[model samples]
Target: MYQYKNNILSIPARLLYQDWSLMSYDTYKKKCDRKQLIRTQQGKGLGNEAFLSYADLPHEIKSVCLDKIGRPEETVVINLLEPFIIPDSKASAFFSNHRTPEGRPLAEPKQRQKSINCWILNAVQLVFEDRGMTGKMFGKRKTRIWQNISEAVNKLDTNKWNHTLPGAAKRLKEKYENYLKEGYGIFIHKGEGNQNTAKIRGEVADFILSHYALPIKLTIPMVLAKYNLRRLEQNWPELAESGLYHWLYEPEQERIWTLARHGKQAWQNKFQHTLSRDKSNWFPNVYWAIDGTKLDWIHFDHTTGHKMASKLRINVLFDVYSEKIIGWSLSETEDHTDHFKAIKMAVKQAECRPYLLTYDNQSGHKMTRMQEFYNDLVALKGGCHHAHRAGAKNNPAEQLFNRFQQQVITKFWFSDGQGIRVKKEDHQPNTDFITAHKHHLKSKEELSPAWEMAVNQWNSGKHPHFEESRDEMYQHPMSLREQLSLQEIMQHLWVTESQKPITYKKEGLTLWLSHTQYQYEVYDGDGNIDIEFRRKYVGKKFIVRYDPDAMDVYIQLCELNAHQEKVFVAFAEPKRKHIDIPVLMQADDKMSWARDYAVRDIEYKRDKTAFEALIARSGYSPSAFIESQELNIKFKGSMPKKQQQKVDAEEDEVLLRM
Candidate 1:
């Protein structure tokens, strides 16, 4: 405390020191005998009446007496204003007396101290405001927070400044920075609902959160712009009217930053490579690894038996530990139905569902149908990077494909790659393997028997490490059955599957999947359009795997963790089949019509040379030919759509008879 009654308080002349030579010698001798005083008694000597003027006061001591006449750091101003800025409940709790367990007020010293501190802070705030200091510099770095706090603490009855100034400044700096970063909410420990947010509160929060989850990335300005626009469109008034944008930017920095930096894939990879896996959890049926492989061996067209195609899809499922191929399906496309059939076959043969099913990031594996099967069978999942991730982390199916390719595919006929390579060397094209086997198989029923023979041979073979065959290894192990009822799991999880690539049109509110254009409209449980539930899902691609047999499938694009993630969220129906027979037939008919019209138009144009030859062959005289030549021109009301050639007078006279 600096004191001023009628005028500024005068300093005592004993506080001023000069004559350093004599003072230093005396201090050196009296160092151990007395205190090392900063100031020495001057010309006043022992006179108690001698008071020095303000000009005579030391600069360091003069600064303490005078309140700084400039703006202080915002944190210092904030600290000063806290007693008034805090809400009513907090103000009461901070200013009130200490409470007992029974809620009775106690006359404790701590309570009296807080009351004094609050009063002192309010007094300091008034002086700072009088000196033109205000809490407006939020962006400015708080450099003088400690100096202001220290000076204010000394004036108050606080022992906070007992430590060294440097140490006190350092601690104060950290505290102020933390307060700025975390917010004034730190002091009161404000919970979520209790905090004050004028701009980003209530519905504004919902709009910001919803927009931020869009698949496309955005900057804070863009998101804020959206917020402003939505408020304006919704006919809500601007938040601050002046500093709304800056106010929103300053407060929700950390939260907005998190949403901005994230991409669509971030959700899927959140815990990808972090968690550890235990291999001791493995068993015969504990984990069944399944994936689709485009088999090297080409398959013949079912009816022709000689029309071989590029490749056939092989959906294989095997016991991971036993290294046995349990079931496989050969199909033209790697579809959900093919995958379901393969897994069903494997489960039925084993008479139990595997506790876990490991799969690859493939179209068939990621399908909603497969996800449903996965949800029913097991919950545990993990994968690791290794030498050629396909063979190592993947199930035995990959290795089985390699072995099957070597023994069967190469023995009969080389694959496309080998065929080309071998043809270049030998100067001869390879014959089809199905050409030899076609005579042996007659129908789809026979095809299964052929595959069964191959599978039986594969299962009966001795294990590479053990004397027991793959079949023996699979049967001997007593693994715990997955708790789900087989019948219930199959009936509940099996959905009639249809899938296609659907593109989201943010503006059009339509999904362009295949050749069909489907709309995304919100529908209620009764399948009626719900006009109130309108949301715009921006640009992103989704595989709409739907139940093909269902009378109607509802599709809506939702957030990444949004419920029903494992199923088709943003939906697609058969916009048009990939190859619609009727549509193709109609297109072909139109093209044929165009070709016939072109031929008829060409035939209708008569040639002058042919007419002259016909007249010569008919034995018409030169007089008759000259008489037959006639000049005529006619005008039509409307011109044709195509450009007409204008006659060149000079060329027409030379080419045609006049």
Candidate 2:
């Protein structure tokens, strides 16, 4: 069989590999006068059997994924139906043929490889059937498995399979034969040369492994020393000097692994054991991941006054669906207040409440106040979930914080290296010689731009294989308006709640908090805070909400389940004003004198006279009216020169008449 007009294989790739699982095949065929045959022969003629390990495949093939050690947990041989391209051949110039609709040619072999990877999948319709010893030598489910293949072959669509049968067969035969010679494209036996001469017996291999592996890991040298001391393994060469180094490092490392505890000491010492579980949710505002990480660079915490002995912690509330940093807070402590503030910002900015929130079992996340905050705002339609404390595996927020540190935090002028920041090395700040540089440390308030930059960069980065940025994904096209309105969210979910006792004062109700008097105007004129609400909730509680900054305090009488508990009657700051002393100067001095006299005369008479009657008819003496006269004189003195002179003349005339 022979065909060669151009360098193109001109044959269906599948037909060549149809007998791949046969284990052995003998073929003698001629194509272009090149004979590539693999015949099974053992015993005297062949000293060793030519066997290809099913697991290992070259990197050029994407159908198989395996570790560098040439082992796959299970064989993953996807049956591909595509034209085979041998790049070194002349027909390989067809590269530019694969173009986007925009008329852009694909990038070299990688693009072609991706096309193959995308189209090929595990064989679905193909299943091998073996007939028992009774059936004809080797009976299999050939008919069912190759219906499509047979149909395609008979139809012989040149568009689909552009290659001739003999050409495809030659292509497969050549590749297969070359692979066998190359040890199935994987390095099997070594370059050890004479290095592997120090023979290790099976029993000694067991002893070495047993000695090397312990609950607390020992260095290779220490392990080797322990192994030699046992005297069970004799004639053992030093590990480094021994050619078994490669074996000990990787492939046969299991010999050492059996006796060693894998992460045994750390596993024992760890406080929390994490188990993985699926945390996937498809809807927007359905899953919120919250976690906090310490920023590498220091910031001055005025509360403690040391240049941030505890560095600033960046708390993030990440939307898992969009991979967006929806909300964040930079705080001195991983306080529940900061946690609430972060979530409050997210809820208000996102305008939707999360049905489920995931957090780690950190002290901040575990606070009773934090739990209450979630209860009051989160609705718990889907309950709260917590990950194990130490590992960030379950918390996507932690992952985002890692990204934040790398992209945003480490870029700062004062960046101490974010230790866990991946892919950015050699940027870690050295503290040993740089202690005096603490003066260059920025204050907590100064890093406002850094936080903004973190969010901007985080949401602006283009997602892999997608046209949209993280911010675009966050503005989810599929999001539906939630049942809860902004009003409801602001009332319950948007604000932090505090419970405090209201003292009933004759002036007004004063609720003491944080050493500041946050006075509130009673919503109902009936004095609910002092009497009605107080009587019902005295020694009980009421919900108080403040802004994210905690600058404004708002007390509310909320009963969400009862009638309109979702609604809140807000108590705002009492609007205060100074009395208009200028306006009071316009009043008559005679009226002021009469009122002062009536107050004393009325007190002596013990009469329930109306203030209107006293102003019209009361008579008085100088002693009772002295205070009012003095106040009149002071009021007149504050007026403008011309006005004050006129008022003085009138006051003097009034005093003379009296």
Best by lDDT: 2
- For model 2, residues 411-502, the per-residue Cα lDDT tens digits are 76667776635444566666653466777666778777767876788789875447998888877664434455788766564443444334
Q: Give lDDT tens digits, candidate 1, residues 1-658.
A: 2222112234343333332122344443353144332222223356433333444444654664354322122112113333332223443465364333224463545444444433443443444464344332111235554455554444332353121212355554564455447532333322222222444554555444434433354554566565564465566544432233333333122223223335313321321111112233243426677777765544455657556554556788878767688877776667666666677677667765566676666665666556655666562333121122443644555666666655544443324333455445432234564556545423433345555666677778776789898878887756455444667544544443334444443222354332344454333454332212212222334444332223255543433332425443543322211122333445754554454334222321222233234333433323432332222123242324332222222222222242
Task: Write down the RMSD of all candidates, one decimal each.
Answer: 30.5, 38.8
What is each predicted model's overall lDDT from 0 to 1?
0.44, 0.46
Of candidate 2, the 10-residue stretch with the lowest lDDT total is 1-10
The list of candidate 1 runs beyond 4 A from truth reads 1-236, 239-285, 301-307, 321-324, 327-329, 332-395, 405-473, 485-658
Q: How much does candidate 2 score in TM-score?
A: 0.37
